[model samples]
Target: MIARTKIKPVLYHVVAVLLGFVMIYPLLWMIMSSFKPSNEIFANAGTLLPKKFYPSNYTTGFRGFGGISFSTFFKNSFIISGLSTAGSVFSSACIAYGLSRLRFKGRKIWFVMMLLTMMLPFQIIMIPQYIIFNRAGWIGTILPLVVPAYFGGGFFIFLIMQFIYGIPKDLDEAAKIDGCSFYGIFGRVILPLIVPALITSAIFAFMWKWDDFLASLLYLNNPSNYTVSLALKMFSDPSTQSDWGAMFAMATLSILPILLIFIFCQKYLVEGISTEGLKG
Candidate 1:
């Protein structure tokens, strides 16, 4: 029995390690290929390690095209992601609070509508949204990408509502006894307690905004306004030899922010997700 037990754990760990490596292999290959020469990128496709470390890809990619630098693309991504994250987190929290705590007629109906919206894919609304933005003269600007985030995303609102549901109603009653208004209760009592959920929402919002390519492509026509995701697409040309090394280099760099955020805030994310359903 002792021998079987030890062997089972060893086998489980071996399988787990293999699965982990399989899942992460593509990312590892991309990072490694970025250090290779443009000519050798495909030539050594099977190899994970580069024959020679070519740092020129970083320089070439950073130069960018049409006289704009990669720095501009990075800055644009940061701006859109930061604003969208802030807007989504704040709006979602407020909406979640209302739906979870406030008693109103048709509240269940509104909540159901919000849940239904989550089932509708972005493609279903893309054309109508584009037409609306074009009419509003928001085309070729970041407005189309950033403005909708302020209205609260359905998924985020749902996530935060679950978190809010887990909170005891006694706190709200206590705040009310202290003469605090609903807004005051939200800002002072609930917001402070729901830090984990808020941070979890912000992380998802920022990562999604940062990696959004289709939205950026549709809204941003000017190269000056291009985000990192859209700018990366510019590296490929079907008519000419594409610079694979530089593309890979920039791609590697693009994921750093997301990786760092997850690494740092993973604890909060896990806590928020695990505990949100405990009461709800």
Candidate 2:
């Protein structure tokens, strides 16, 4: 058993090292390719490392979109993502608190309905949703992408509800005994205990909004309104040519923020996932 356990750790470390290379290889490729000239991109594709790294591709990528700058796209992405994430996190937390910590009629039915929505694919309602937004004159703008976030999303709701459930009911009851209202308990007691939950929900919400491609493509018609994901589109031109180096550079830039967010919030994410039933 001791030998088996010792070998297990060795095997795990070996597997982890292999997986790390697999995960990081694409990023290293992107960084290297971004430095290569457009011609060298395909020619040196097999090479793991570039002979010389040039910073010009980043400059070219920033200047790629006609008159529209990378900064504009960055700002638009930031606004849309920030608005949607805040709306989703706050509304989801409130819903989760109500569902998990409070007793109410039809609660189970409501939860079932919420879960049912998660099972439904976006494809099912895409066309109808597009039409509705179009008629409301919300399409070709950021509103369509940001507004639905206010209606707590199904996955986020479930995520926060699970965290809220993990919090002891006795804590809430104790707060009540001290003459606290629902809002007071949520604000003073449960809220403090669920920092892990909030961080988890925020991270998920930010990631979802950050990497969102379809919704941005659907609603943002104008080039000026593009997100970082859409920056890759500009790297292609059927009439003239596509710049692979520039495209790869932009892709690398788009990946970094999401990676950093995960790095910062990973601790909270793991903590939030640990299941502990309410004590009441």
Please give each candidate's TM-score: 0.97, 0.92
What overall lDDT, based on C-alpha atoms, would model 2 receive against the true structure? 0.85
In the range 246-266, model 2's lDDT, one tens digit per residue, is 888888888888889889889
The 10 consecutive residues of candidate 2 with the worst lDDT sum are 271-280
Residue ranges of candidate 2 with Cα displaced over 4 Å: 1-12, 275-280
Could you say which candidate leads in lDDT?
1
- Model 2 residue pairs with clashes: none
How does candidate 1 score on lDDT?
A: 0.93
RMSD, one per candidate, in order: 1.4, 2.3
Q: In model 1, how many backbone clashes occur?
A: 0
